[model samples]
Target: MTEFQTQIQAATRIVQTVYGLSVEWQPIPGEVEVVQACIGGREELPIYLTQSGEQTLCICYLWHDDEIEPSRRTELLEAMLDLNIPMPLSAFARVEGYFVVFGALARQSRPEDLAQELAALSENALEALEAFADYLKQ
Candidate 1:
């Protein structure tokens, strides 16, 4: 297995054992390998991890562009910007058509550290969904 894949596998095991979360390898068609870690079995807000070069990134997709409440888009954007600094290890970002919460660590970080990052990212994602519930379409 490649170094990146091996690191992801180790981090997955750490997350499972330390956090008691379920993790699945996602078959995303791309150069970067991805892992989906389910926080409290809430598959809808699974954290996705990828390692490239010297960094490992964990991301959680909060919602899609079409899911946003049209009138509240500006408010949501402003709120996200305000929350970015105070949200611990995670930050709000737009990836293509999706809104996401993400964290990054050095690629050579310990498995335990990666696990913590995944956990933090997962928590931030849930909080983002809750905080922005009114900004999204039901």
Candidate 2:
């Protein structure tokens, strides 16, 4: 198996055992090497893990463009920026049509570390939704 695949497997086990969370591996339609981990109870915020030569990324999609209130877009962006630094181990980002919260670690990080990242990203996703609720369409 590829290094990332190995990492994903190990991390999935750790996340389940350590955090008491279920993890489902999903394949992206066209991306052969990319898989997403859907955490139980937080299925709305699936975490996508990707690896490069130097680092691994853990990202959770938070909201889509159409989900945001048109007039509050700027304010939402500003709030995200303000919260970025205060948030632990995660930061806000825009990926194509979605807004996301993500964290990164060394490519060689331990499975425990990866599990921790998954937990943090999951928590951050929920917090982001709560924090930005006013800027979203009801």
Candidate 3:
């Protein structure tokens, strides 16, 4: 197995053991593997190990919806930026129609550290959702 494969296994173990979460490893031929798991009860988080030279793994939480109001778009964007300012180890990103919070880990990160990163990312995403719950009400 390759170094990344070994690290992936370690990460899976960490998520399962420490977080009490199950991981579904989806390996694409000739590409990096993605580990999928549900965090914060309703959100599915995707953990990706970049195939580029950086050898970094990123855990991302995405809230995708086309229903975001145009009037609230600027408010949401500003809120995300405000939350990102003091956040440690993670940041908010907007991709397509999704609002994302992601944390990156080095290829050599320990299993414990991986677990911590995942937890941090999950908490941040949850907080963001709660912070904007009023604006996001259906």
State TM-scores per candidate: 0.87, 0.91, 0.73
lDDT of 2 by residue, 1-138 (tens): 677888889989999998999999876655445778999988878898888668898888888999999999999999999999999999988999999999999989999999899988898899999999999999
In model 1, where do residues sit more than 4 Å from their true spots? none
lDDT for model 1: 0.84
Model 2 segments more than 4 A misplaced: 29-32
- The 10-residue segment with the lowest total lDDT in model 3: 42-51
- lDDT (Cα, tens digit) per residue for candidate 1, span 1-138: 767667777877987898888677654667667766666667789777777788888888889999999999999999999999999999988999999999999989988888788877887888888999999998
Which portions of model 3 show Cα errors greater than 4 Å? 19-24, 28-32, 39-43, 49-51
TM-score ranking, best first: 2, 1, 3
Models ranked on lDDT:
2, 1, 3
Q: Tell me which of candidates 1 and 2 scores higher on lDDT.
A: 2
Which structure among the candidates has the greatest lDDT? 2
Candidate 3 lDDT tens digits, 1-138: 767667766866887788786665555555445555455364455544443555465656456656566678778778778878788778887667677777776667776777777666666766776787655637
Clashes of 2: 0
